[model samples]
Target chain A: MMDKEKIKFTDEELVARFQQGDERAYIELVKRYKDRLLNFVYRYLNSFEQSEDVVQDTLMKLYTSAHMYREIAKFSTWIFTIAANLAKSELRRLKRRRVVSIHTMGYDDSEYEIPSEDFDPEKETTSNYGEKQIQEAIDTLPDQFKTVIILREVQQLSYEEISQILGISIGTVKSRINRGRLRLQKLLKDLKVR
Target chain B: MDCYSFDKVISDYIESNLSAKQKQEANEHLAQCPACSEKLADMSQLLGALRTLPRPVTRPDFESRLMARIERQKQQKESPFIHVFHEYSRVISVAAAVLLFVATSLFVYTSVVLPGSPASVPSASIRSVEPAAALPAAAAGVRPEQAGGVAEKTLPDTNRVQNPDYNSRIMMVNE
Candidate 1:
């Protein structure tokens, strides 16, 4: 039984240990990634609960598919790729379940309107209000731009790292980050104004 | 650098991707150009906000929840088929029993009951009669008795009366 506090294995080493049936290594691996993965997924999903679930799901995959984790790729890259793919598919599932109420009750409504119909004023006065606005701005971005921006700006991943994760060229990552940032700037200009 | 060229390199400039010489040129252009400088400032502020955005912390039980979930997942993956079977075990067993019952019943009917029935072959023999049953009252009684006896016995000797001359004599006598 390894000391939970004293185990200092790297992700790859821990994964190797996990494959060797070290349950402690698995716990340590989950501890190492839970927060970072949660933050990364929360930014992409814009829902903390869903992000938590997705992180759990991602870790579960990492646990079960430990044998599939060859050492050729960095464990962070492989794990982050799993996280990204799960987040993307979750977004697709959410999108499919999202009903387009553009012509509700035979009345034309703006499709791009932020769904503040259920907004609670009490919740708006809470802490980190600007952060919520910024998140909403990020949420308005296109999926391609949204993904690269979150991976870059939020996760602070290098362009080359993001390129590998997204399977795109570094040039594409750079251009997307630039475009995403510019779009975000436009959307959040009002935040600066206030 | 003119504004057009500055626009293209501004992102690289903010990200520190520009060469030193190009950086110096951009700095010189920014010194002379307030518009481009303000654009750069906006981009910087945006990047700062994004980088400094407050992240939500996972709850204290995040690991426990994940581990519990992982354990559940491992148990499921260990027996994916068993999980499905367990979920629908009653329905599946009932369906299997019903299918087995139907199959066994069919097997018994075909192999034992059907082949042993005396009426099975004789029913085919009764259908063999074609024209001679039209001989009026006399032949009608004979036809029915033959048809009835054919159900319990092998076919009667129809080869005797099936002769054309015999049929003609029987038809003349009847008329």
Candidate 2:
């Protein structure tokens, strides 16, 4: 009965409880956000394992820094900001690692294995291929457009929420979402042609 | 509206964010323009696909792992050393302050007070030393006899020699 009651509490209410040292409230908050954060982070990183790590780190930060949260900002916006910042850091770290690996490779070193994208008759269908194509198109977008597109289109967050998470104006969020969609349309069209 | 202008307002039009007049203009333009209409269709299709994309779930043990990490973090926060420090912090601070006060008082006594104590130097020696010390006063314009008498009358009886040999050495070194 208590668990069911906690499940009904809003994210902000849960955070407020957690601030007052309610351990169960923290657990409930984690349950509510973990998968959502994983999905958001995975879209940004395109790597499930790293996304999970980023989400864990984000929750850990929330655990340690719960006192820093102010009631003025929406709880979702604050949590998503932490997830997005960590995802961006992870992306940068991956890029740096790739650069280092490239620099260190020698002619005698074995060739890096590229994952095959061969069609699987049993496992993959038309919808799967379309989804893959759309994801690839999204991946090709610039960071700003990709983030806005994922937040607006994929996550289905309000413009106000995206603006708060990204620390931008609502006008900027709308413009970015529009431009991101336009760019995504072009990328998908290009993909279909290929 | 031409294709370029229609492109500019397409998103606003789709989102119903345009004013009625602008929206009406966009509608009339869309009716005649195949290219602009196709662009809108493509954008709609892309947004639909994005919305329906499969959301990935975390691994099965995600909760357990997070709880374990949180437990470890709690343990670290409540570690014995930190716990002890927090418990005794006020007492430690007060002790430190008292020690500092005592050390400062001792330093002041040894450096400023002890050297001036009468037992460190007899009062008779101070009176005898004052006459020799008055040579500098004499040089500064007072007559030697007047400087000696002034030094004798003005020098405090409680004055002690800082360096035991400071006055006698000066007297012997000069004489």
Fnat for each model? 0.47, 0.47
| Cα lDDT tens digits for candidate 1, A1-194 | 46754356678888898899988888888878888887898889876667777988898888778999999878888899999999999988766655544333345542332212333212332223367777878889999999999999889998888998899999999989888877887777766576
Q: Is the docking of candidate 2 incorrect, acceptable, medium or high quality?
A: incorrect
- Per residue, candidate 2 scores C-alpha lDDT tens digits across A34-150 of 988977887788776788899999999999999999999999999999999999999899889878888898879753432213412123222323777777887899999999988
lDDT of 2 at B7: 77
Query: What TM-score do all the candidates reach, one by one?
Result: 0.67, 0.68
lDDT of residue A193 for candidate 2: 87
Interface RMSD of each: 6.9, 5.7
Q: Where does candidate 1 clash, by residue pair?
A: none
Top-TM-score structure, candidate number: 2
Superposed by TM-score, candidate 1 places the C-alpha of residue A14 at a distance from the truth, in angstroms, of: 1.3
Query: Highest lDDT: which candidate?
Result: 2
> Residue A148 of candidate 1: its Cα lDDT?
95
Native-vs-model 2 lDDT?
A: 0.79
- Where's the lowest-lDDT run of ten residues in candidate 2 chain A? A113-122
Error of 2 at B35 (Å): 0.8
- Model 1 misplacement above 4 A: A4-7, A100-129, A190-194, B77-82, B86-175
lDDT of 1 by residue, B21-127 (tens): 99999999999999989889877866776777666677777777776776776687799898798789999999999999999988767756664343333444344
